[model samples]
Target: MKIYDEKHLKNIVLLGAPKAGKTLLAEDMVFEAGIIHRRGTIEGKNTVSDFHDIEQERGNSVFASSMHTEWRDYKINIIDTPGFDDFIGEMIAAVRVADTCVMVINAQHGVEVGTELIWDYIDQFQKPVLFAVNLVDHPRSNFDSALQSLKERFGNAVVQMQYPLNQGESFNAIIDLLKMVMYKFPPEGGKPEKLPIPASEKEKADRLHNELVEKAAENDEKLMEKYFEQGTLDEDEMREGLKLGMIHHEVFPVFVTSAKKNMGTGRMMGFIDNVAPCPAEAKPELSADGQELPIDPSKPAVLFVFKTHLEPNLGRLSFFKVISGEVTTASELVNSQTGAVERIHQLFIVDGKSRNPVDRLVAGDIGATLKLKDTYTNQTLHAKGYDITVQPITFPEPRIRTAVIAFSKNDDEKIGEVLHKIHHEDPTLMVAYSKEIKQLIISGQGELHLAVCKWYLENVYKLHVDFESPRISYRETIRKSANATYRHKKQSGGAGQFGEVHMKVEPYFEGMPEPTEFPVRGKEVIDLEWGGKLVFYNCIVGGVIDARFIPSILKGVMEKMEEGPITGSYVRDVRVMVYDGKMHPVDSNDISFKIAGMMAFKDAFLRCEPQLLEPICDVEIMLPEDVMGEVMGDLQTRRSLIMGMDSKGNYQVIKAKTPLAELDRYSTTLRSLSQGRARFTQTFSEFSSVPFELQQKLSKQLQEVEAV
Candidate 1:
């Protein structure tokens, strides 16, 4: 294999909805480029992209696969990404490094929910895109309707570069408006023979050809003037104009393809190689400090690791793109995040499970290396003294959460280590040990996402884990002030412990001042490690309790706060004042004072009308408008407060505040209700008191569990 420069490298990513044949099209593209002799199908479970065992069982791509091929003297690095929303993290990583996105659309379904979802990401990255209407030979395929839908949803920027000459089931030929020629494929469908346009289709081809020339000319002033004078653009001029137009997102050329039959794939590859923006022409890579880095092989070496794979027997493989300069085998580079130097011993160009060893990876090329000691996904590796960090890929936050429990006692000891490995492979899947709830919480994009993680744990690591509904982190706080007193005395033949405490417990809020009715001797406001504040005021007029014992008293109060009087939940937003207390000279040690303080705080908390507060989250749901009524009604049942509503094209976004306790399995429920046409995200908002009836129920449930 020969190394390609930045100018001749095309980093293209395949993106679309699930079952849109993105993986099949990738197989065709690879086969068309002569990288492989025969194309593989998803059903066969032998495709280059979906090679993983899990993907083979599911018959869908679950991870992004990197493969490249040389065509027309240009190296096209094709990143085939999963279309399922649960695996959106893979697509995001691929899109981050891609120069152009080939969004495959299902001809039968037109624009689907998955396509719309990925379109938002493509728009976010501002990547030039080409639409490949795949599955054109399907019985229900509707190319015209699909084209109309594209025009309606994405505007006139979607211009047809090629259209199928025959309808569904008879789709064997494609008419190229750009070239003004027809490509008639053999019945077996490999390469097509080029011929003049049919007499019946010449008029329509001429009309679309003129439209293409006009769209291309609009990208440049000189091209527009030449088009006005010559009434059309020459082939060379139109290609240059289209390239410029694509860079600015002014044109999104649509191509026709029957990936299953290998129809129109060769022409799609030709357009990508000739017109798609190269690495140097696409957006410049930005450093972590917001400065654009030049894409030059002669500059200091800098690489961004976008994806990491833990192969069964091969160990860790870090897939990266050379952002600047060139990296060679056995060259040393520093991990920009850790500042640890690592040697790149063997670099390989990845093609799914197969790796082609390469001595060097130049700028704009994508490849993988094994055993990078200090390198991981989203980390930047650069030459020494360069000190430049590339901006990391931004992954979506986990949407669904559940507590993971080991099935066997022996597996418990190894769960954390296994989870850490899983997290390293997919950063979007998070594993957090909640000390307060005493559970290991695993969260991901949805139920399927976490399920896949569980499968990996059981199959790969041989550890069985089960997911359970996580306990809600409710807080207990008082609504009014109260006063209580307690006396502590212990005698066990040793130094007797005796201390009496009288204190006032009041609900605290930010900016509240100390009580002025009693003289303030000392004051300490401590912010609880969990949340809220505990303001302690010492108002002992004549040192009723020694000043040294005040901290001991506060500590006891905090201990009571940790295990609240009402429901054993953590207490918050309470202020305590030790205005009066009695201390014995010999027995009023820190231990005695702490016991007295704890008793006094608990007594007061019980008498002050305490309330249980549950966490609230701001949830934004995007769903089709047809399901808005049903979803909104369901939300009302969950005690949700509808905040606002907005429109996003054909979808509606419903913003609401709902208690986290009421949102268990909400992602799964929403998918069922909307037929998998809805997506949502939630973030912690604030905590609010639970309803009186709900509080009693929770208290009863807790008491029952404790009794057991």
Candidate 2:
């Protein structure tokens, strides 16, 4: 195959809500372009985009795949991304790198949350976008209602560039408003037969044509004048007017197709070839470090690594977007962050799991390279000293978390290694060992996201894992002060262990002295440092207690501070003043004073008001307006503090403060209540005093667990 430069090609991502038939459209496009031997069904697991085992078994695209095919004289790089919100990170990455975005809307379902999300992203980047109204042959498909709803919800810019010729089984032809021609299709795939509008559907065709002409006239003044003078527009003039309006965001051209039957796939390809925006066509300016960088192929190289992978077979496939300069095989690229240059050996344009070697690449191209050292997703690739890094892709923090482990326990040692591979591939999925809870917690956007990862582990890495709820990281604090004196006397045949010490324990509001507090506590609310000054005043004028044992007592106190009292949690924010004490010079050993210090700490902690602190999170929930009542009721049931409720257009946004324990699996419940329309984000807000009843329960549970 001849190498196609990025300048001649346009990359548009097919994105929408789940079950929008994006994979079927992909398969149909490949079959129509003559790139595949036969069209493959999603369930058959033979489609080009949904090739992975998990995707095939689930009948969906989990990962974004890069597919290249030609339409007309233009080269198109089509990206098919997962519609499930769990893998939304992939959709964000695709839109960031593409020149224009193609959002597919199911004719029956209308606009969904995923569609709205991608629309906002495109608006954010100021990228021109196209809308495809797909699945026209379905029984429940309503073209007029859907189109009207799109226009009402989005804007008046929605223009009917193409219309379906029939409904249900009769949906074999498409009427092109741009060319003013009817392309009819036979039962089998071939050149669609051209026919005149049937007598029964002529009135429908006339009404659609009048609406298109009026919209086109409204888009262009010249076309308006022609329409007013002649009461009609030439098909060519209307096409040009619609194209201009669409490219300028003045009009949204809606096309129709049945991807399952491969009907209208050929026409859809032609529309894309004629309308998809190349990198230069939209003239989007790339921004970095508050400066606009020109997309010059002759300039020094600048690319962004949008995705990463560490496949067992292929060590690493670092996918990147060429932003400025030309990148050819065998050349080297520098890591702008690390200042280390890596040699490029083989460049592969990835299509699903298979990769095609490309000889050379230029600006605005997306491709993959294997085994890049010191490189990961969101890293910048540029020339030496090129400090300009593309602004990172902003993603919502992972909300759901679960504790996972090796099912057989034999792969425990390899868990870390296997997770690193998964992390390299997915930046949104996070893994960490929580020392507080002693569980390996994995977090992602939702349940489907983590389920897909577990599936990947078993299928791709051949590892079985168990999933459980994550344990909370609670904290303990002391309330008051107490002083206690402890004495140790052990008589033996040779030497005797005799040590006595008296110390006063007080709350250390300022944390420890200079060593423990100043440096590490920078600006934290609590301070616990080891360099605190323990003043051993030696007030005993008679010197009953020797000074030699002071160091041992202080050391013991520090040890107790680490392995706290009441619970197995760390103790903080306290000061001990060892003003008076008596120690035997020879018999007063370190062990004797150490024991006294531990007893003193335990005594003081018990006297003080030691209370447990629970973590609270600031949560913001967004849902449709109709669900507001149920949402408020649910919040009250969860003991949530309602911050406020605001409106975003037709949607209601609820702000509240909720405990972390109550929100662990809230995403699943929210979907059930709102019919999969609600989404929320949570951030650690502050620590609050736990209720007395709850604290008592936790104390009892901790005691029982410790005893076991």
The candidate that wins on TM-score is 1
The sequence of per-residue lDDT tens digits that candidate 2 reaches over residues 386-492 is 56777777776888899987887788767767777687668888888876577888889888899988877787778889888887766666667566777778888
In model 1, the Cα lDDT at residue 400 comes to 82
**Candidate-wise lDDT, in order:** 0.90, 0.75
> Residue 707, candidate 2: how far off, in angstroms?
1.7
For every candidate in turn, the CA RMSD to the true structure comes to 1.7, 5.2
The alpha-carbon root-mean-square deviation between model 2 and the true structure, to one decimal in Å, is 5.2
The estimated TM-scores of all candidates read: 0.97, 0.84
Reference-based lDDT, residue 504, model 1: 94
Summarize candidate 1's per-residue lDDT along 1-708 as a digit string, tens digits.
899999999999999988899998999989988989988987788899999999999888889999998999999999999987999999999999999999999999788778888887889889999999999999999999999989988998998998997768988899999999999999778899999999999999999999999999999999999999989999989999999988998799999999899999999999999999999899887888899986788898999999998888888899999998899997899999998998999999888888999999999899999998867889999999899999887888888899989989787769988898788779999988987788998889988898789888899998888889998888999899999999999988868998889999999998877587778888887888878888888888787898888888988998988877767789999988888989888877999999999999999988999899999999999888899998999999999999999977667899999999889999888988998888888999999989999989988877888899
Clashing pairs in 2: 480-608, 480-609, 513-532, 516-529, 516-530, 545-582, 545-583
